[model samples]
Target: MGWHIEGTYFENCNCDSICPCATSGLTAPADYERCQVELAFHVDTGEINGIQVGGLTVCLIGDAPQQMSDGGWKIGVLMDAAASPEQAEALGSVFGGQAGGPMAGLAPLIGEMVGMESHEINYSDDGRRHRIQVGDAVNVDVEDFVSPLDPTELGVRVSGIGFPADTLAAGTGTTATVDVFGMEWDNAGKNSFSAPFAWAA
Candidate 1:
């Protein structure tokens, strides 16, 4: 079987303006002794093993020690509640790195599986601004750093970081409170990045 998905992705973490994980290619230690972050996604169009999976949303939350590449990460997955059992399961395989797609590239960095949860995901888009809300569990929003010379463009565009897209827009958390899997953190004013994403296998 084969699978493919394409959409948008944005992430925020407990780093400064620019996340070291992005700049150092996952090799630098987090700004703090530990790391806390969330990767939220919205699938505009996709399928898994022939199952339609468009309009679904998912978020990956993690707590890692030092460099992200050092592994030993405690992570959790959150899927939208609207999905059927089959859809949910299919998403789990893709996100859990079982379907052997781009996500597989990140499997080695996971040390502990915190499991998955289902909820009504709310994803909002406003130009370079983005927001993710799931009841009280997650409340986060971010906006890209606009180029000083070109207010309509991102201040920075990074590439070759092994992320969703070859180049990503860098930003910072405006407000956030991520709580799930018994781990929580506030990413307010922390590092954030966003980009349009497309993946296949």
Candidate 2:
């Protein structure tokens, strides 16, 4: 059995300017030497082990100690409530790094799996702005940067070491709040961005 997923992805972390997690493979020291963050994904189309996963949403909320690559991330996962039992299990395996795929690359970075649950997930994108909500666990809003030279155009496109490598739109978090997995943080106006992504295994 194999799987492939492609869609939109974004994240909000309590970091300044560029987030080191993307470049250094480890998160830089944040307000308290830890990176509290929320990552969301909207699967426009996907499947795992023959299960359809299109149009579902998922989220990861947690914190990284010291550097992300140092491997001590305590996190929880939230899947769309609309997913059936089988779909939910498939999503859990994929995102939890148990199914071996693009997500397997991230398996080593997670030190603990605090929890996993199905929740009402809301996600939307209106060209320049993106919004995501995972039940009452997380909420985030981000707006793309407008080109300084040409306000009519979008901001710079970023390319780097992960999914959505070339289509990232640089942006700032208008609001980021999370309360789950024994972690609590608010990173309003922090580092955030959105992009289209594709992954397979």
Candidate 3:
């Protein structure tokens, strides 16, 4: 049976504005010799194997080498604690790249999956502002840039990032941190992106 999900997603990374990985399709090297990122999403409406997973939040914590296309990333998953056992299992299959979807394309880039854990995930989306917090362990928030002439419109958007979405609105990370899986980062004032996404497998 196939699963389908549609939601809003955002991510923050320790990269300068206009990250090469995001813009160059992961063919370029990251700044500061490394890449640390947190990808967050809120499932507005979704189902995995008939299990409803709407209103749940998930985050992917990852660390990659300079050249992301070189293909070696240490990653971990944090799921909303509100999920039931069966829901968690189903959601994991979709995100773990076992169920066949956009995420499956990223499976080969993973060098190690640290683990998956349930946590009290707090995610909020208000237009250009997006935020995610998991207790005190993880925090990431981004604010999309807007045009000076018209503050309501996004300033930058690009296609082909390989994220489930066709185009992404670029932003700046106001706060980004992670303290899990023996990994820690204090990456603030970096690159960020937000977009509406739909995935099916």
Candidate 4:
């Protein structure tokens, strides 16, 4: 069986400007602790073996405990409500650390399934900027990068990886966190990145 899907991805980490690890080639915390990135993806144009899949949301949990290599990665997945059984299985497999693609390579480091959350997702694009909402779990809103000193704006770019997303993100009035495999994540940022990507077949 074969499948292909196209859509956009968004992510925000606890790292400071430039997320040093991405370019500086340095490990997280540059000392003892690790760096974590909570990535949320929305599939605007998606399909599985010819099935029309739209409005499906998924998230990825990434980290660089010992730099890029040395493995030790963990990932958590969330499936949309509209997904059928087959679609759910496909998504689970692809995101559950199977297939050995970009995410697959990081599966070995997964700690555990921190459980999945079913929340409403709202997205809109007004050409110049885009907006995303996590309903109840969390709220992710971003317009565009203009200036660096701007209080509610973050000016940065990551070329292809959707870097420098949401110059300023404010977490809603909630405590959203995921802890597993000795790793803990507190969703506090209100802005993230949205980009398109594809894994191996």
Residue 33 Cα positional deviation in candidate 4, in Å, after optimal superposition: 2.9
Off by over 4 Å in 3: 150-152
For model 1, residues 97-157, the per-residue Cα lDDT tens digits are 9998778988998999998999999997665899999877899999888777996564677
Residue 175, model 1, lDDT: 92
Flag clash pairs in model 3.
none
Residue runs of model 1 more than 4 Å from their true location after superposition: 151-154
Q: In candidate 1, residue 41 scores what lDDT?
A: 87
Better of 2 and 3 by lDDT: 3
Model 2's lDDT to the true fold? 0.81
lDDT of 4 by residue, 1-201 (tens): 555555666555555344545444333442325656666666676655566666677755565664644555554555666677776776676667563345565566565565554445565544225444554444444434456577755444445332222222222212235453354666444334444565435
Clashing pairs in 4: 9-195, 10-193, 73-109, 154-167, 169-190
RMSD of each: 1.3, 1.9, 1.3, 5.6
What is the descending lDDT order?
3, 1, 2, 4
As for lDDT, the candidate ahead, 3 or 4, is 3
Query: Candidate 3's residue-wise lDDT over 1-201, tens digit each?
Result: 788989999998888886788787788788868899899989999989889999898899999999998888999999999999998898888888999998898899999999998999999999789999998879888898886887657567878777658789888988888899888998789999999999998
> Which lDDT values do the candidates have, in the order given?
0.88, 0.81, 0.88, 0.52
lDDT of 2 by residue, 57-113 (tens): 889887787566678888899889999999999888888888987677788878889
Error of 3 at 175 (Å): 1.6
